[model samples]
Structures are given as C-alpha cells and as structure tokens.
Target: MSSLYGLRPLPSHGRFGYSAITRRPGYAWPNGARLAVYLGFNLEHFAFGEGLGARIGPASPEPDVLNYSWREYGNRVGAWRCLELFDQLALPTGCLLNTALYDHCPELVSAFAARGDELIGHGHTNAERQGDMPEAQELALLAGCHARIAQESGTAPRGWLSPWISESRTTPDLLAETGYDYTLNWAHDDQPLP
Candidate 1:
C-alpha cells in the first residue's frame, strides 16, 4: 500500500495477523460481565545517573541526582500511597515489577504480594532497554527475570511488559519460548489480540 505522499507503507509485525474488530466474532467476558478493568501498576528501579528515565528538567551530566531522585520518589512515597488507596478500594492490581526492587526495597514488593496482587515481570530495571540487546542476551534476560520473580513471589509470571515497552524483532517469539502467556507491548486495539 502507498501513503498520500506516495511512500510505501511500513512493514507489518508478521506475528499479529490482521482481523478487523467489526468482522471478528464477539466473546463474553468472565462471569457474563459486560466490562473488564485492570490496574497495571509499575514498580521500577533505575541506575543512578546511568540509562533511561523520564526527565522532569534539562539533562545534566553523570550522577544526575535531580532526575534520579524524581523517579525514586515513586518507589519511596508515591507507590505506598497508591497501595493504600488500592487496598481501601478493594481493587485488584497487576504490578509490573522490576526485579531490582528486590535489592532496593523488597518490602514494597512483599506488601503488594501480601495483598494477593498479581506480579508481572517487567525486566530487571528500567535503566536498560531490552530491544537493544542481542537475541541471546534478550533471551537470557527474559529467562532470568522469570526465574527471579518465580523464586521471590512463589509463582512464575504469566505476563510481561518490557521496560519502556520496547521490543526487538524476536520479542514475541522469545516470550513464547520462555513461557510467557501474554505481553503488554502492543496497543493497537482495546481488546486483547492473539
């Protein structure tokens, strides 16, 4: 297909075969409910002054305490408050976790686990992007995260959400090979895709 500018369309991610939403058969939700809601809470950790993170101000040199601390505030304070609210509301939460939290603040992860929240793998830390790694390295990373989460949480995560939502060409295949049942990498539709 060609664009208005006469440029060829970009290649597709071949794994996701197309199926127009309107043409696809409808399915009922669990408990015959008309709606479904899930809270995806992220709990990530970043290296000090090294690697990617959301910056609030202009970039600075190494040891960027300003940006590092800004992101840190989430794990330090924000997450706790959010946890309290979730508990009070009796909400079920799926926590996309960075395994590094095991070193930084294990209590936080334990608190969520104690509440019977679902823990999903989200890489070791947000400091690095999985998309940039070589295939073997990415596989190792995925497998390691799976093992760690299973060991810590007492169950393997059935889902994954890459750091920064980044993925290499082989991510989906790797996810399947490594035993992940689903991923949050794609957002082309409101409903889940095969």
Candidate 2:
C-alpha cells in the first residue's frame, strides 16, 4: 500500500503484520466455548490540577476540582461498590492500574490483589502521555512502573496499557524489552497479535 503521508513513511510499531481474520485458522476458547468475558477495571490516578484528564465539563484553570473530584470518586467509592458487585458475581477481573494508586490508595489495590485479579501496568499516572516522552524517559517510565507494580503487588505485570491508549512508535519494542508479554493498546483485531 502507498504511504499515507507520501514522502514521510508511516511509522510502524513492527510488532505484527496485518492478516485478515477470514484467512486465519479457527481457534476455540477453553472447553470449546464460543466466547470469553472479563472485566478490565481501570484504577488510575491523576495530578490534582496540571495534568491530562477526561473533563466532565469545560476545561477550567489550575486545580480543576470538579474533574479531579469526579475521578477521585472512583477510588473512594465507586471502586468499592464495583468490588462488591464483582465479589457477588464471583468474576475474575484484570485490574489495569496506575502505579500512583500505591501512593494514593494502597488499600484499594490490595483489595483487588487479595481477590486474585491480574494487575496490569498502566503507567505512573494518566496525567502524562507516554507517547510524548523521549525514548530514555519512556524507558525509565516503563521500568519504574514495572518495578513498582512488582514490588507492591507481589507479581510483575505481564501486560500493559499505556495511559489514554497513547504510544510512541517504539512502544511495542519497549514493552518487549521491559518484559511485557502483551499490550492492550492495539484492539483492531479480535485475536491477540504477536
């Protein structure tokens, strides 16, 4: 295919080549189940005023209390409620966590860990985008997150999901070098890619 940007070639992550699903061989879920479902519960933290966040209303000046409190509500109340529901349902969950939670609410992270949920690395905070960092800084971010999660959660994460689903061109390469087995950043295919 022609390069979308003409002279400037499209950046490639080099993780996997495109393959049509119809041309691929069939695969079955465990016990021949037709489908599978699991909860990807995001437990994130953000800087109080000066970082990226999903605004409920129009953007305001520093210390966006309205949006900050809105997100904080998840950690303070919504997460506990959801935990109760998950317990009642007896469901397995994959907790995509920001390492900042260790500092913000260690108890909450522990609750999920106690329930045997898979803890996946989700950067230090959603306030910053990984794609914007220089390669060295990005590497440090990935390594720091990995080390922190492993130390706090008692197990290193095997998967990753960059905050805001943002990624630099070398993100997959960095993930592999940082010992991640998979990433949630790419969701174009129904099946996992190599």
Give the number of the best model, judged by lDDT: 1
Q: Write the per-residue lDDT of candidate 2 for residues 1-194, one digit (tens) a residue.
A: 35664666678656678789999998677898888786799999999988799888887788888889999999999999999999999988999999999999999999999999999999999999999999999999999999999998779999999999999998888999998999998888887666
Global CA lDDT computed for model 1: 0.92
For every candidate, C-alpha RMSD to the true structure in Å: 2.2, 2.7
TM-score of each: 0.93, 0.92
Best by TM-score: 1
Candidate 2 residue spans exceeding 4 A from truth: 1-13
TM-score of 1: 0.93
The lDDT for every candidate, in the order shown, is: 0.92, 0.92
Q: Candidate 2 versus the native: TM-score? A: 0.92
Would you give me the overall lDDT of model 2? 0.92
